[model samples]
Structure formats: structure tokens, C-alpha cells
Target chain A: EAGVTQSPRYAVLQEGQAVSFWCDPISGHDTLYWYQQPRDQGPQLLVYFRDEAVIDNSQLPSDRFSAVRPKGTNSTLKIQSAKQGDTATYLCASSPGLGYSQNTLYFGAGTRLSVL
Target chain B: AQSVTQPDARVTVSEGASLQLRCKYSSSVTPYLFWYVQYPRQGLQLLLKYYSGDPVVQGVNGFEAEFSKSNSSFHLRKASVHWSDSAVYFCAVRNSGGSNAKLTFGKGTKLSVKS
Candidate 1:
């Protein structure tokens, strides 16, 4: 079975530029998540979707960041105006469901974004 | 809000030596805990998890973690270390009563093993 897949393994952009990261989750998984990992730090959850609906996006930076899992299968995270601090690896993960102790997130290799 | 703390930023050990990585969590109630390992240039992978029941839960690659409710700690352990075990390990937790899918992670502990 294929694991979570992300496109554009690497991206280099300048400040104020826009970029989008795509993720295709594992088949049969009901929950999908997006995380941002800055250098030397663990990945932090940005937003997540349970099926076609967003379950939590409280941590997302509203002004420039947006995410969509329209069909509940594939997801896209967009940054309207990138910043130097936005340079990080964007990761996507998936799990079977939200049931307690039933979910085990499977992650993708992640897209490394470098904003100048 | 729930949070996780990995006190050690890095740990170095020789092959065949025992290893222990500590993790602490703060939450209003008992939270579901997990340990994930990330290889170089790769994504994070689950090593072990703890919800309820036995404090010790075995995970992949002969790794195990003991959950101590008394101290609100979940520490990863291995009887013997291997050079292949070098990687960054993250400690995470999620509210059991709330959204079980959302996780809060620690800064991570990078383990280096010397042969």
C-alpha cells in the first residue's frame, strides 16, 4: 500500500511570493493532517481534516496560510505571502479515524520550502 | 491546552548500551502519549503509543516506552542500542476526551549512536 505522498519535494521562494504544497493521503484513511517543521524543531500541526471537513485549524496563520481538502482525499496548503520564517518542511499525514487509540498517523517525506 | 516536553535535546550512546529518552506532558487530564522517530530527510514514524492499561507499550525496532501517570511522564527505553537507531525522536500527546487526532509535539531529542 502506498503511504502519504507529497509533491514538489523542494521549493525555493522569495519573501512575498506565494507557494502551494500538495498532499495525497493513503487510501482508506479518514483523517488527514498538515504539519510544519522548522529546522531543529519537531513538526507542529497547522491544520487537519476529518473527511471533507476541517476539524481544527486554530494553529494556522490566517492572514497568509490556507488549506483545503475539498474532496477529502487530497489536500493543499497555500501560503499567499511567504516570509523568511516560513522556511520549513511541510509534512502531510493520515490516519484511519478519530477514534481513541485507533489512529496512527502515516507521514510523507515532506516538501522542504526555503523562503528567502 | 495539552503540551509535551522532551527535556533532552540530544543523546549519544554506543552500540550495545541501554538507552532512555524522557518525555513529560501537561494536560487537564490523562492524555494519549506517543513517540515518533524521524530519519534523515524522511518523515516521522510512530515508534510507540500509550493510552491506558499497561504502562509499557512495545513498538517497532525493539523499542518500548513506560508511561508513568504519577509523574506524567512517558519515557522511551531500549535494552540495547544499535547504530541504525540514530534519528530524531519526538514526544507527542493528544487530549483523550477531545479530538484524538490532533497532537502537540515536543522539540524532539536527536539520538546518535556510535559503533
Candidate 2:
């Protein structure tokens, strides 16, 4: 099976510019996640979905960030009026299901975003 | 709440030398544990996971990790490492039996293998 795919491996934007990232998870996977990883730091969860319904988005920056999984297979993460701190790699992951035994997540190469 | 801690920021080892990277987690119970490796400009790839039964589990590329319940630690070990094994290794933990899908990861340890 093909792994998760992310578009535009890298992006550079000026402050206050808008940017969007696209992700296509592996086929037949029911759960998808978006994470932000800064340089030299671990990934931090942004949002997640379970079959088109958001499971948790508490960590997401609601002011300028939004994510949607319209068909439950593909997702988009958008940042509005980008800030310098928004510079990071955005990663997408997918899993077969919930629970301990089924939660092995497969990740994509990630989209590196930079705001100047 | 759950968190992972990798005390070592970086480790240097020569080719064919034994290596060990430490990981400690904070959780009330023994949750699912995992070790992932990330090459430069690449995403994370699972090395191994621990759910139950075995304390020591083997992973891809001759990697293995031992889960210690008494110590709340899951340390990864490699008998002999090659230059290709040089990468950032992250230790992650997830609470067992949850629909949350939140995997807490440590800061990661960058391993450098010199020939």
C-alpha cells in the first residue's frame, strides 16, 4: 500500500500571507492527524479526524489555523496571516483505527513552511 | 497526562560499536510504547512498539527496545550500528485503550555514527 502523501514539500511566505497544505492518507485508513514540528523539537498535534468528524482540535490555533477532512480520506490545513512563528514542518499521519492494538500511525514526508 | 523524555540530546558512536538511547515516560499505567527514527528532511518511521507480553521487542534494522514497568522507561539498543543508522530517534507513548490518537513524543536524540 502507498504511504501518506503531502504536497509541496516546501513553502515560503511573507508575514501575513496565507498558505495551505494538502494531505492524502493511505487508503482504507479511518483516522488522520495533522502535526506541527519546529526545528529541534518534537511534533505537536494540531488536529485529528475520524471519518470526516473531528476528534480533537484543542491544540490547534483557532485564530488563524483551520483543517478539514471533507471526504474522510483527504485533508487540508490552512494558515491565515502567517506569522514568523508558524515556520515548521507539517506532518500528516494515518491509522487503521482506534485503540491500543490498532493505532500504529504511518506518516508522510511533511511540508516544510517558512515565513519571512 | 502523558509525556516522553529523552535525556540525551545527542550521541556519537563509531561504526560497529554498541549503542543505547534512553527514554522515560510519565504515565500512571503501562501504555503503548514506540520508537521511531527520522532521517534528515524525512518523516518518522516506526522502529518498534511495545503493547504487552514481551518486555524486550525487536525492530527494523537490528534495533530493539526494552520496556521497564518498574522504571517507566523504554530504552532502545542496537548491537552494532552503521553510518546509515545516524538519524534522530524519537520515543513516543500513548495511553492504552483510548480513542484520543494523541502520541506524546520526546524531543529526540540525534545519533551520529562515524566510520
Which model scores highest in DockQ? 1
Task: Give the per-residue lDDT of model 1 (tens digit) for B37-72.
Answer: 999999999999888899999999999999998899
Tell me the tens digit of each residue's lDDT in model 1 across A1-116. Answer: 99999998999999999999999999989899999999999899999998999989999999999999999899999999899999999999999874653457889999999999
lDDT tens digits by residue: candidate 2, B2-108: 99999999999999999999999998665899999999999999999999998999999999999999999999999999999999999999887646678888999
Task: Looking at model 1, give its docking quality level.
Answer: high
Computed on C-alphas against the true complex, the DockQ of each candidate is 0.82, 0.78
Going through the candidates in order, state the TM-score of chain A alone for each one: 0.96, 0.96
Clashing pairs in 2: none
